[model samples]
Target chain A: MKPTNVRAKSLVPVARGGLLDRRSFILSGLAFSSSLAVSNAVASDKISTSKIDQSLPPWMKTPGNGDTEYGLPSKYENHIKRDVAEHTPETSIFSIWHTPIENQRGIITPNGLHFSVNHNGVPDIDPQKHKLMIHGLVDKPLTFDVESLLRYPMVSAINFLECAGNTAPNAVSLTPLDQTAQELFGQVSGAEWSGIPLKHILQEAGLKPTAKWVIVEGADGGSHARSIPISKLLDDAIIALYQNGERLRPSQGYPMRLFVPGWEGNANVKWLHRLEVTDKPAFTKDESGLYSDILDDGKIQRFSFHMDVKSVITRPSGKQVLPEKKGFYEISGLAWSGYGKIKQVEVSADGGKTWAIAHLDQPVLSKSLTRFYIPWQWNGNSTMLLSRATDEFGRVQPTRAHWRDKYASYSFNHYNAIQAWHISSDGVVENSYA
Target chain B: MPSRFLYPRCLKFMLSCLLLVTALGQVAAYADDATYTTDLGVALSPSEVSPYEITIFPSGKNLPEGKGSVKQGEGLYQNHCMMCHGEEGDEGPAARLKGSDGWFSFSDPLRVLRIDKYPILLISVGSLWPYATSIFDYIRRAMPHYAPKSLSNDEVYALTAYILYLNDLLAKESVLNEETILDISMPGKQRSVSAWPEIEL
Candidate 1:
């Protein structure tokens, strides 16, 4: 949907290149524009329903469309959708859909729009027939059907799931400058997931002292499997059954999926069924080849589950144009960490040269997306913009160069670097490396 | 009714005691505390779970039975995989399996020269996969792209053998079974390490 007009035309500059301290101004009862969200700025005055007569508008004159059992976003919101990034050459099923984070707000990703990468495609599983088995090196080898599994004590966690390969800055060929923040780094999304804490199941199975690793496997045709340490599963893992308080969408793994908070996404095996405890790491095809990070020394780095802190400016991102060449724009984006809550996010309008603190949206949940904002008065100049997020653990998101220096060489996965976007003098925004 | 009268009536008293015990037992089982274990799943026997134990561990655990020679694998590859994996396993739209070995050395880290294999990156059992068993495990789980798990254990072994043979790691006549596959030392076996020093974190 389109917006009427901006209300925050005058914001005091807090840093170089017209960066305004959004939190400070808002707290002091000063700023925030209503029309900042009116993207696709093809026309200045697209929709100003408020300016219409006070008596009635088009919607108010008639009864709304018949209600249905299931509801959907308004028809105007159809523009916001998950971008299908790529699939196996032509198979189309082995694919990855990028969440349009540019259009989304707040921490929880709508269940339907959550980013997904499927190996053998989304399986329409019958929850009635679905069963999760926890076996090997355990006193009791337990098989839990959906009914019995639901009987277990349930726990909910609001956490972010990020693909290991999300935002591989060095792999520019895969994600070019013409794309939006979602196309570049949409593999990460936040959600409120409710499920039985896996430790409860593991404890019931009676984990053997020798059980050091648990090879969690999906029931999908790909049999997508990963060797996760038993310790992590016991710590904060969940057998997630519901997403955003609803039965998980088919793509989100209906009935059940493994949820290892703060760990890499692939390890959270969707359509999860089996967990085999073992003494040593299994080094399955996924852990050994697919998700393994080939390092500088040519040695493969496996089980680097912790996703580092990262952020990206989604509003006015690639392909979007600023309505005015120079005006007040509330810069908005997401910052999150595998380590913990994002402590601070610094916005840089002049690339990395000048940095200013941006407001971390309220109730900054740990291991969840923290939306940040900074009201800026654009000077209509060709500028490079990026953000740096420092997590609670003191781990700051690194620059592309710095990250490459640390990891080095072939990166088929796990690259979190500062995403820079350029705004041209003509108001066109493009993904930037400058 | 008197408390003494209730205590004296054994039938009603026994029934009440049983109900109280059962309620207490359930309360103990489904406790609200996070630390409490529900012990709620059905225990299955090993034999019942045997059919689904598909995971093949690096240490050769769960490696299936049946054998296939590289010669047998070549024929099977031609029949099933050659369409996508290419006639020789090198020329394919999918991930190339076999290639002439000479990795562009990035020892200096700064100067990484792209030499030898270009355009199509080489990531196969011979060049990259740390374990030989994984080649079989993967082929068995996902192969032919169009039809997964359609291959019999022998066919999976056959493809694994052929791929290894194409990489020059195995002879044409060499056969691979559960035991033989374990003995085949892969080049990357020693080079793989966890990104985190401790997997616990």
Candidate 2:
């Protein structure tokens, strides 16, 4: 059956103050956007209307479209752009831009606005000249040009790549109470990446048994390189040449990138130019001096690769106004775990005092974003809202205090504590550490 | 067993035959013939290894032949690095690279004690970095920020030596080369270990 525009007809009245009853409240405001109306409509199993409207809206009045080679999102979505955060404005090289997570729908982050962290700035690479050299512990050293690598067997996997330093930049000290969801957790993003399975190429080169690590280096000005465990590389790493479905954006490594399914974003080196099989890590400056974190007692933590389970409530979060006090609203959010699939997401309306399980949408693949929702009824009183995620391995999202008690002294990387949003009596939502 | 139309033995035989066929059908239905191999991409010659593989390990196995002194390095640092890393290499438009003794004493006293014990957390070339060879690898790959990989082999070694000298890990007269870089001991070298020894971060 052809799809109809359901959003146009889903409008309902705004419930306010003490005037609303349970029955009336269920039929108004946030209730219209809930699953009840849509599920009821589907169960009826009838066309939207017995008689259709013959007249069409402006653009639809004539021929629907003239065929084009490429497609673009609707003009209404112009506001969906990556927001920039300048760590060092003097040089554009060492800066980060976060994906507008709240503005995006579903698990797939678009190619244009995928979160990017650059150390030495994005390079303008010539695909024709780009070559991937593999040597060191391999039986036979090989250099595969971009064209040659493309011809090899390819695989597609939908995975999320997150920076180890994703949420640390927006630590409580740096962000104000009115910080938006994008500002806090926009560095992580998911995409359907397509490329050659690194193992396939490595097999051809005959990887030596002694080769325990693989050194991946980018072609950017920084020549960004990181040593990855060979087991991780052989298991699921891909030399990703495409993002979503098209060529990789220049900022995201362009001609080639090393895409490790569930590792920190930096480990998946962009603009990949070389891979050296080695018995030990290269101990590059990035891995040794910069990425490593030190504890309060001075012991060092190195190679903290896998991102942990984390969740954040996006809708009705910080900086968003409720529009009306006591109105019905559906609480929604995104959850992900680098280890595996998100098993469950719990929503708490009264802080940690109580929590209700939110509905996890279907197609919950491993290491990809999982969307969750629950119907929340507001009482016009000041209240706290939060979401806590649990992954397939039964790991629960910890509170900020609990997380700090354990990790604050040692490191600032991998901050995945449950975020709380406070809705004041005046209908303003603000970030709350509690 | 009590069927009137057929004998019990006959019925049992027929049921067994039916079950066998169903099991075989399932096996056949699930079988896939897709091939996982593809004969694509070309191999490389052994000669390509020396020219393209630029990585320098902690063991100093693959370091190129080059030498530089603090005197020469200071000039290179001023010409290529000073604008971003500051003249003394402590203040920065990027990360600070020197002055470990007084790092956080002004801001927090506890930090001072921590640095006194394990100064690697201060993030300079001498205190935190484990291997001196990594200095050359990093400078060759990512340094001089805007013009990366622009420095010659000798220049990279010179800058590596100068940064180490500023941290007081190296003497002014010491000339750094591939043979001497790996021997240079860093204060944080003994404690620094790669491959994530800690489970939780």
Candidate 3:
């Protein structure tokens, strides 16, 4: 039989029946296992931190290996990696690898760990062989090789790409897994993308007045396609050539991908090879049916492109245990809005009864991640921690009760409700809706 | 359908226009360089773009010449599909693709229901998709699960017809072509609404 629970005794005990007594009954053997490690660290404070090393550290004594053509992260950082999930383990082509946001710090996610949602897996594309085609309702069809696109004047912006289907498990009525913030909300990632404006090429092709939408198709095996309004194309859209200052990663659409700032990630088509101008939205399978949100009302919300304002605390989240029963800990998390810059993010340690203003990191860029934090003091009592973010346009992240009020019987996609992580008296944190 | 204006790149024409544009700054990254080089891309004839032009829209544009019926699709389904999608496409080890039992017939998850596992919505045609073109378009792009884009145009049309027939939208004797597929009015067609249509940007 499979057992989901295992108990661990708290080394430091608080008052009786506070929360430490209940932490032993929590889900997962991982928390029980980590409690032992936490106990060990407490027993050997100075020695655990390497102050009393038996010998000189191997890396300090020996010279490091020769340089590489391309650098990789240190072996110690191997544990920090994306959590992958497929439609099924049998079919490898369709999958998504969530970024390990809990193990990460700072605003920008590294290129390697950047969250990925590949419908046809990563395609092996040769830059030399790849060419971008612009046709359909244009005055004339045009084809530009990679070299030609590189020569065009380019623009760069730091933006976050959040999948429309991101963060529903914890945000909605879906069975919340004993998961980290990375597993739940890691579908959102920020990157510095550099590329030519899409309109630059469409202008060369000469958009006909009849052109109201642009159907961007990828070169992946599925030829995954989605339709975008022509107005957004002329606004801040780009055919991205580089990601985080390097030739685009193969998984991130090697030669090029369409980048629509402040919009849903699928609309920013990756592995882009063609842009067909049309009079209306293509009603593609992904957009019309898949990405579209099903509301509580009888109507299904299609073409809901703007990602709502959302935030989540990465540390002190599910599975991670606090080392102390009573102590001061800086609560930190990432926040972003597809609508505009985050105006403010408020934190409430005691559920929603009272609130404290969290500090927003300076120079908040629109559509990019904004890290928020506040000094939190634990009082050895079980309590619920919550956070809410407001954007420049004044759209605040709604509560779980508010979110469910609007969504349907089985609505799953576009879930960005305010997260509630319950902190036990023993310092174990878990996802809590009650 | 030929357009009116044909712009050719010239250094002299660009240099003169460049001076006038410098006086007025830009809002976003883009400024209309060409009165529309400002033509770096090579112009292509219709045939050159034809090889990659398999995309089909709601308007039934770009569908290749082919025809298929439910009978042909039945044989093809057993050979290529049936394993993951199952005998009726509803008894799935994969996605449920047969039935469209109106709305809200599936299980709701997590909280109030205490769903022991992650909820996977089993969406089928007529319930999920609004346009019939999307079914044919999706199958042409991705299908048979293991080997994608390996099916013939006739096979794609056949499968499209079969799936539609299974959903009770098409008759058992129905044959689908580019024109006939567009004529299908999916039950879920008008069910979709924009959550926030006022945000025009």
Candidate 4:
């Protein structure tokens, strides 16, 4: 029922046995589709060269467009937006807006599309009055205003931040009709952050040998705070002042935020204002009551900071209608690990019957999103597609069954399982469990 | 192969080392004098901290001087918290505080595995909260949705005691103070698990 003329022509037959050639199959397939579009228009309209209007279109008929001080994405890309979902029905005070991962490209998430999770609500902060206070178990307690913090030496790091509650919906039930890749797993985002490292500030304050944890608090209505170990802060944490070469957006913690690389999104305290160095962890409400995961044995797992290895095929993902069945398509997805870099991503087109190594995009950095792609020729058969990622530490993404066995089904945090997308015979892709 | 450039290179390297040593001596002398230059942040004084800088740790080390009885807390609850948290703290808009059935059990078993039967079905301040100190900190910092940080220290203590009493964790006649509040053991803390599974690659 689907057109195979383009693919049939591209393959050269052998004399002894009929075998299809593989060279430039993807390239030629794309070219054939474009040519087919033009041929269809010509055949339907019967318009020749003499009757065609050669003048440029209305906008291009005039002079070239003038430049603006600030540039925005093309008008055609208006559909790309951060999708907001209300987590609490009592009020929109606590809400989550997810990044459109299905529509994004490369590793870095744009400033506007960065995911936002707010407790109480996003606070309108005046940077002029904002100051960061560093005290408790330090030789010299220090306070730095916005201008003073800017004077300190700064560093830039590209890392990913994922919410621990990302796969909460998937763990319960996954339906293709409603949820897409972005809707299910869009709580994670990557950014190139620029700021002074917390270690440099700690060194200036002179840390007491007894200092073990640093309680970072926000300036929001909740005064949301979390205690992180001193070693994690000293290792890679930064007081991020800018994101993606611009001062942070209000929802992303305007003026400043504490960026704890490779940790859960909540640990990166937004609207950061205070850092109290202490000998013990501050078992805050968010850490103990909300984010902490309870096991099947009735014991709680505390401070599970790092996310596990995970990958999801974004292209050919849920809700996407394939243009044609039996057409050549390229499967692309995102892979990330909180522990380290993603070493390899293996994609299966037949529900894990067989897997082929997907090509990793260049410049794969640790604790950042890595893009991977593979070309496949659809057989017009209803099949499932899955991507499994192995991190540098050799930790492979596990199945939902294995994960649920270890942790309780009600345990909603820190869920990282291999996602599968089903392709129907009618050329419709959907979210499915393989 | 050329001796001419080698001698000059050696001399330059030696001279650089000598200058480095001299510079190191000056830095050491400055350290001995307790004088240093590392531009960073401004030193903060205790008085400079904001009025809302109170954070109670798990050890109950930062509990302010305040005392309130369960009788005193009931009035505050009716006036401020009852509208959203419901009567008896179990029925509310946010989270339930007093329900005991299947509290800690999330799965179908509907029973907790722990030996100590402390009902923790709902994630409320009383049942699931690990630390007793979090109650005071959370209430003081964020409560009474319309007007936060409006409660006095004594009112916060009273409200905390009333919620604990409603959960059957505290006695109706008990008055909670800085010292007495620490002695109130939270059931969630007893069942807390510290170790994480070693996830090998």
> Largest TM-score belongs to which candidate?
1
If ranked by lDDT, best first, what sequence of candidates would result? Answer: 1, 4, 3, 2
* A1-434 per-residue lDDT for model 1 (tens digits): 25324454345677898897664453423344543565675658566667556688778878888987989998899889887754233253257788998888888899889998887788778888988998999998988888877766687778999998787544434344477788788899999988888887887788888998898999888788888888888888889989998988888877799999999988889999999988877777777665767676667677889988988898979889988867768899999899889999999888778899998888798888999988887888999888999998899887776776655355547788888898999989998775
By TM-score, the better pick of 1 and 3 is: 1
**A146-232: candidate 3 lDDT, tens digit per residue:** 887787777788899988878766544445567677777879998989888777788878999888888899998889998888988
- For each candidate, what TM-score against the reference? 0.85, 0.81, 0.83, 0.82
- Each candidate's interface RMSD (Å, one decimal) is 4.2, 5.3, 3.8, 7.4
Better of 1 and 2 by DockQ: 1
Misplaced by over 4 Å in model 3 are: A1-61, A86-93, A171-175, B1-37, B101-120, B195-201
Which of the two candidates, 1 or 4, achieves a greater TM-score against the reference? 1
Tens-digit lDDT string for candidate 3 (B1-201): 122334456656876666667656633333424333245677888889888877777788888889999999988988988886767765444455665422333442222221222133334555768888888988888886677899999999999999888888899999999889988988777776765453221
lDDT of every model, 2 decimals: 0.77, 0.75, 0.76, 0.77
Candidate order by TM-score, decreasing, is 1, 3, 4, 2
**Candidates, DockQ:** 0.34, 0.29, 0.34, 0.28
Ranked by lDDT, the better of candidates 1 and 3 is: 1
Q: Which one is best on lDDT?
A: 1
